[model samples]
Target: DTAFPAVHWVMMGLNPTGSFTPADEAYTMGFEGREAKKEGDMRLLKERAKELGPGGIAKLYMDKLSGTFADGAGGYHSELSLSRDYGILWKYVYGTHRDYILLLTQLFYLASLFMSLYIVINFIKKDISPEAFVIMLFVLGSFFFQMIWEAGTIYSIGIYPYVFALCVLGLNAKKEGEARKEENDDVRKPGFRYGNKSGFFISAAGFIALIAVHLRYPRESVIVSVDQFLFQANDPIALSDGMEIKQSFVSDKDFSIISLKARNFEGQFNDSVYEVSLKDGNGDLIKTNEIYGKDMTDYEFTTMDFENVPGVTDYEISIKKISGENDLIFLYYDTGHTDVYPKGKMTGITGSDTADLTFEVYDKEEPGE
Candidate 1:
């Protein structure tokens, strides 16, 4: 390395007949006069060596040499950017301002309870009996909301089927004046009215119970088969890119059997391998397996078995691999919605603290099917 000559303007001789030079000692001693400044500086550094610990001086010099520094830049204007979309930003800024969010949350809760009361009122007025609604409400109050944590979407869509089914059950008795009183007069006899009330009431109760179970212990059962999936083009409520499966069931037992035969598949997978896994909340290595293999060129198939697995809260499959793209298919199990639910305050902060019904297999048959 090239050395630069010291270019001090003052000389040691100019200061006094002393061992230290005036220019070198200028900033070395605060108020005390410098004495053998260069040698004294080295001695002072060595004196504090014991307090500084080994390598402390070396690290300090290294830091100075590298020009590295600790910056406090992360404290402000460093929050994670969620999205660049203006609407999303606007929503974040004002849509759920603290007060409004609290109000909405409260209203949603109030509505849930009010709707239940309304359901009960109409049920009694219609002179119907409990079928599934009993089980449904029990499950809802027990654990579905707090456990599953599926809000808004489930209520918006899930309540539809239950209401529609209940309405069908409710209106089945409402009849028009018959063209011929003798032929169309189907006034259920007073004695037979007991049976009609018994059936509809029992059904309504059962419906409530089914929804409650769906919310409480969603993963307990899965509908592996359906009679016929409602098509979006036909059923306006079923509108979505997702296909709906009609027949579904839940399990009361853990590690329950789930089997599905691949019905149909059509896709051109370029390079990737389809992957599937059962993941728990913490995302520890739970259970994973390759979904489809190369030999499945004709009609690809996939199956995974889990043993001694505790209750699961969520599950999904992904066509993922470093290679490129892939695809696979399932039978009536496709497009199944969430049934596992999270319930109560601080649900996410707690674990397996949710409540659910001990019964299973809520819906076994569809009327008129």
Candidate 2:
């Protein structure tokens, strides 16, 4: 196990490797300009597809869509790949899930821009300056960069500026339209005109809301569920012989309770109860706990608390699947490359590739100086 890195690789670099290397560095090194590079990539994909067949094509598609070259192929497997212009176009029209966030942002921005243009031309009664175009580019670029800064993809907040600006403009337009309508005493006209600014703005908001409902909300819910299973905020300090993830921490404040997600495969071994133990640095037992697979029910992580852990130094915690101790299972640790050392080695344990008992240690905090 490893302590969580102070900064995530994505935070330090646009590349997950945490470097400033271009995502398509492998594809673009020999080629120049955007079109030439794209053409070269297409050629490579075709050549590979012909050689590898459909499976290779599928793998290449996943690699291209992700924008990362994790598979050693030229294609990059970045989520950013799915959020770019072409990815979004394919997604909305074809209902593909290649990129998650870019399509909606692009649609909202384009709609707002077109709506603004139409209003200025027909209703604003003022000349649209050349500076507006420059401002639009500036706004778009700034929004685009901010997404990369926060997440690796254009899925978050990149569309907020466009949505906010459009909403404001729409409201102002509606106010102007209302004033004009009242002044004309147009009793024959409908109360809400289809051509009015309010209508377009409202439509834009509704469109965004629908997209949020269909995509963003569901995706977030799944992510939250997965987060519960993994210690994401900090890195695991160790992996038990059974491959259970472990970590060590020091509590500055007095607390006796702790919890963690059970390391069971989805729907496998969920009905069995496991014995858990907490021990002090002296190898003295402090508390014993138990959890059942039925109690976990689905992917919910099980938590156990030890009363009166007291403010102490060097505590160790362990969990063991006592119900089916004899069962043997093969564990596959992904080391990216097949020949990578240590992690790529075969299981030394006879019954399980993972440690039947997992352990996490916590250092005791010293009293205030």
RMSD of each: 32.0, 16.2
lDDT at 235, model 2: 17
Give me the overall lDDT of model 2.
0.40
Q: How would you encode candidate 1's per-residue C-alpha lDDT over 195-296 as one tens digit per residue?
A: 657855775686567567645643322222111121111111210122221221222234422232332223334233444344444445556555343434
For candidate 2, lDDT tens digit of each residue in 223-340? 0100111112111122233543222233333444455543343345444556666666565788888766556533233445564356664555555555643221212233333222
Span of 10 residues, lowest total lDDT, candidate 2: 221-230
Clashes of each: 39, 20
Off by over 4 Å in 2: 1-154, 161-246, 263-269, 325-369
**What CA RMSD would candidate 1 show?**
32.0
Please, what is the TM-score per model? Answer: 0.21, 0.33
